[model samples]
Target: MGENSSPPDPVRSFSRLAVIVQLMMLAVVSAGWAISDGTAVAAAGTATAATAAVASVTTPPMGWASWNTFAAQINYNVIKAQTDAMVSSGMKDAGYQYVNIDEGWWQGTRDSAGNITVDTAEWPGGMKAIADYIHSKGLKAGIYTDAGRDGCGYYYPTGRPAAPGSGSEGHYDQDFLQFSRWGFDFVKVDWCGGNAEGLNSRNAYQAISDAITRASAQTGRPMVLSVCNWGNQSPWDWAPSMSTMWRTSGDIIYWGQSASMDRVLANFDSAQHPAAQSPGHYNDPDMLIVGMTGFSAAQNRTHMSLWALSGAPLLAGNKLTDMSADTKAILTNREVLAIDQDPLGGQGVKVAEDQTGRQVYSKVLSGTGRRAVLLLNRTTSAASITARWSDLGLTGSATVRNPWTGTDAGTFSGGYTTTVPAREAVLLTVTSGGGTSSPSPTPTPTPTASGTGAIRGVGSGRCLDVSGSSQANGAQAQIWDCNGQANQQWTSTASGELRVYGGKCLDVNNAGTADGTSVIIWDCNGQANQQWRLNSDGTITAVGANKCLDVPNNATANGTKLAIWSCNGGSNQRWTRS
Candidate 1:
């Protein structure tokens, strides 16, 4: 990856294969590559092309902004320092491609010629030098502007505003042209449509979008258009056609700074839908507020995971040079970031709500066999949520690998359940349970035992005992009498761990926890010995015992004894449909 001496448009020379290979290389560096065939390669190629087509101009914007630690009090010196830091920090090699000047860059008045100019006192060498310096670093420059007629600043931060005869106009096309002339590679146009004095606000956004597209083509520099109208408008539905990414949530104000955790969670919750967003057009959940106002490592990890899972841009609002090691670790976690940058580009959905009101977001990764499940606990109390194997379409058992700990939670059946502390998140990658499906076998005889007596319940309280044991986790179980015992109670946890009401999952008892270890419910902790597979034929088999439920020699008699024996797929190992 060396600089080109040729005069070719370095950006235009980026070919499909080159970009895909680069992305594949990055995936190999960050995420492990799955064994992919032509179909998967084609799918990845298409996704990469879409991403490159819309995102090629400004792939990973890596410039400094004033919003993170310094809000509006930023001057040109700070911008220069950030630009210098981007080069010195080796971030350029990591693909931070843009140095954007957020807000505060504008002054009240234009030049005597009535054209917008950089503030001389603030920007001494003018914007052209800054742009040159950025380009010299193999990166691009970005700037911000408002869409309204009049910028709210008293000095008119963005000139005289778009008022009816203020010598200034609020035309998106004109503004876009002006920005293009400034050599900007990215534009974050905001303050449009939501204001009270704006004219035809809804149409104004669309107008700006049209103007951006037209201007980018005119400049021949392909500027990345970031629509910043907030999530008030469903950007997912409308903004995709306009820009590369639109803000899908209200402005992110930093951890423990602006709003409460509840507000943040609610904002992201409402924005999840229309799971069709791919590489180019993305649903932005606003900027990263991590590492700002002194956020902890754990909090930042939570922020990164949730944002990545939502397919939001990884734009860091915090000052990069002033970051801590812990903060860097959280931000640089490749495993968590891959979930967000996956080729599928699908937004994570709220799978379940916890008792403390936390949420679990499940995002299926690029491959059909993998998933990134984020357990986010937003409340002040420790909360736990369960993802069932059946609910996630997983079969039998899976290896739940926690990304943060870099450790495997062992192969588990049902689903993987983890407890997250308040205001924290747990991100895991789950390899599919191998028992997703079983091979079809020869049909066996259906049981038909004529009995005048009713079937007795086995589990606690009112359980149905269709004359036999219904001893499987996913098995279609019925009600029966309590018998004041572990066999009477059934535990139906969503994570695929089923136990008798007040007992653990029926164990082979020690796991000999012994043969003839009557199926007794025990604590529903995840252990291979306790897990039972509910076969399609209504037979229950213990994973460790390697035995299936034997209906005592396939007797077609009422109240046949249920016992576990080595798996032979015999008639005795099957049960009749209830």
Candidate 2:
């Protein structure tokens, strides 16, 4: 009879079952989306558009960062002293403007409202005061944070942990606002506990980027975002829109007393990504280890030269106040700086390599046809490295100037061969026509062409080539061996432009009507100087000035520069399309 009574309570049983279903649904929603611990623990959405109010940094920032030298032991007094040293040491005048405080600047906990507070024990006067002092000296201030739930490093002096929930994970907006209010000009966001949280790197960084944009609007301060994820997740693929610079390698350790050679080589490999380099967005190979004790004088030179040629941000990690003359010389070379600061912003490439541990890296300077070459000998003993003019896109003699010595190493023709010590590099600027020019005496057969072929000089039989096969503006058009390279290929465009390399037009330098003006390859601006007409008599005439394209001195030798001369119907002026 009792079992039968249970059947009578069927309606009640259904009601209980409905209540259980509702509870399960509520639990699911709570677990999926809930703000916990004053941080956004939920997954991030797509990145928002960068704010227009904030201008993108057009060059790699030159500054001094704390983590490399001082690490977590940094304090207000140390930063202030460094700022003062920067000025007295002439570093500030040399363009090292930002004074940065790395990790351990924050208290172990955020306030009730999730706002981060400076550790009063280390920063007795607070961070704003420090920023103010730095600004008074005409320098900017930078601060660091982590993207994880807990920071990466601990404060060894205080014996305190990187406070839990102190990172930008769930509190990006709050922390960004706090950083802005503190007058920070730069923010370095690291990925410490981020991966442990199971967060996607792209989403996590985009969240911080959005917060930076929002905070910048509220505070009206332009903050340079430095992505310091140690090059994980290939930040170069996506960080340009969000940051001014990014780390492409791990922390450069002081291997011995100077920069570690292995780390330097790693950075060189990272710099091979050409598309990562641009105006304002730079490929950071970490700080310059020039003044550290572990490296020799030769290693220091190699370190600085590679950083400059690679377009890396030159953040001096050494103690500026106690630097030696040699260290200062390595760090403050204006000629080296010129290559790093060139307007072209093109990272140098490894143009030549050999099994003997010798390599050549080359970069084209903006506005000048000069090429900066670094001959590196990575072997344990001295090695001879040869840089053929052909490999460097030059055909004639070039004056080799050593920027480090501020003196010319004399003009070299054909090729410049030098012996470099082990673990050292030779930095030279190869400029066309600065050295003695020797015309080739060998007679080349007259080249024939029909369509889209090399424009062979009838007098020299050498093909018209873009110096160094360079697609850059102002690259000289010169006579070289007809090798069927795209830089030597020419085709008449429908717009009356003699185009090469797909779209660059054959241009008369500066549109000058005067004789002896060099010919160059420039963007198709539809300008008169870029317009040319191939006449029936196998002569290419400048459409604007009506001058004939002639080889200098009617030289039938390779490496002869091409120019616009008076149309005299000479063989040097005769050019076959093939």
Candidate 3:
């Protein structure tokens, strides 16, 4: 055979060897790519792997949302324009990053494979394309869905019939995956359909949260879940664990309008739930109506100031494309944003209110002795509002800086007083002297106990003890052995506060009316939940919810927890003074 074709075809064998090596290299690259993709997914999914995810936002997100302006008029084009406007108008540089499409972006039906689809007519380029455009502008994209079968704007006239699969009720996992696939960085889960479906607020929010976590795990994308239940269920009690921010009031209509004050006041009241505000989870008071025409420049400043001081999400709802100079200035104030973005994450509180409709709100800022104070004039005419340092837990003099004016308002000791125009606010940062200081002590509880002694649980024969003798707020009040400890000693105050553990008052957690809601000691906020009336019949009753303090299960165990329950006149509900 001619020596087997010259022993060997060296050239052909070399070519074959080269092809084999290339194939091996390609396989190795493919494996590496797969591993890299898997690692990215793992990191993104880790934020939501557990039922209760740690907060993703260290500060409330500053952004622009479509609901307050466009409502159901949102579409791919509108969002794209807003994204472009955000960049071109200097808002992006001012820290406004999110461009959220509020509602009406879904098709009326899911695909045969049970996948949610966008309204092709409205979003001709599709949500993914819109998200890509937003990302190109270095901004995040957000979308809206209802927790139930329909979103709040599901029936809004968007020139199309309402979508059948518009919400995330039975399709939470599917919708979450679809949103993640579309590159949505945020989701505002509204409650209209869910509330209509008779789902409990807590359970419904938790389910969607778990589904989002799973979807994030699968898609390798982190999504901010905003709970939009309109504060109907006191979401502050449970939404913190599940959502980045929860709406604490109904929609804010127009800025500085007479009727909008109700929404603002409702939010301010809801923000009083201090337990709900944290680094990752914020109490949303709804979108900012800052640039709207109805409000004056001063009023707009007030709106921005309050939102910032309260640690509420500052999602500007105005048209970014044509914002006026004054509006831009109000929205872009860096110093005010610093207070809202403070790491302390404390929600500003209504510390003082006067008969003239003047109110003072205060929040402790990040640094020691640094506080943000707001003097609000809610009246029809201009009035002088005062902020007492002691009311804000500050004793010594503080250098007051007007954040809006960018000027020092001089140092003040006892308090600061300023004239705020009607329906306006003065925002100030009070920086205390660097010396070591302490707040004026809380007023000692006056002994007003009619019975003047230990409150003994009649059936258990144990004393009501502050769990662990902890003086911290929200410490559970429970029955314990009669140790004659300070925690077990109780004195009923004239103001109806069950003063125990020094200044802490016996409180019904969240003013819960339900059976088995924990009884804890909280700061006396003069809320009805902290008020109690000692009945002549030897039973103690919560003043507002009208529930009696009863030991859970009527058990006589030493550590049985005390809760507020219906007044059935049970022996366990009775309290006797020793």
Clashes of 2: 15
Q: Candidate 3's residue-wise lDDT over 317-401, tens digit each? A: 8888889999888898989988888865666755565542577767777566677888877657999888776566565788999
Model 3: residues with Cα > 4 Å off, grouped in runs = 1-54, 155-160, 254-259, 354-356, 434-437, 440-578
Q: Distance from true position, residue 320, model 3, in Å?
A: 0.8
TM-score ranking from best candidate downward: 3, 2, 1
Highest TM-score against the true fold, candidate: 3
Model 1 alpha-carbon drift over 4 Å, by segment: 1-64, 87-95, 112-114, 152-171, 192-194, 254-260, 354-358, 433-578
Q: What TM-score does structure 1 among the candidates reach?
A: 0.61
Residue-wise C-alpha lDDT for candidate 1, range 73-111, written one tens digit per residue: 566678777777666655554445678877656643565
lDDT of 2 by residue, 1-578 (tens): 00000001012222222223222332332343344642212212111136232324555778887766776667788898999988988778777888988776774476778777777877877889899999999999999888877666531223335466546777888888888998998888877667456556668887887888898889999788888776555666567656777776456763223456755754555444444455556777787778886788778889989888887888888887788888888877889888888765566765555433577667766543377888987667999988766555555788888999999989888778899988789998888664222222323222321135578888888898988877678889999999976678675532245656433568898888889999998755546787666665677778677788889888977778899999999999988866
Q: Among all windows of ten consecutive residues in candidate 2, which has the lowest summed lDDT?
A: 1-10
Provide the lowest-lDDT 10-residue window in model 1: 1-10
Off by over 4 Å in 2: 1-55, 154-162, 254-258, 434-578
RMSD of 3: 20.6
**Could you tell me the TM-score of candidate 2?**
0.65
The local lDDT score (0 to 100) that residue 496 gets in candidate 3 is 51
lDDT measured at residue 273 in model 1 versus the true structure, 0 to 100: 39
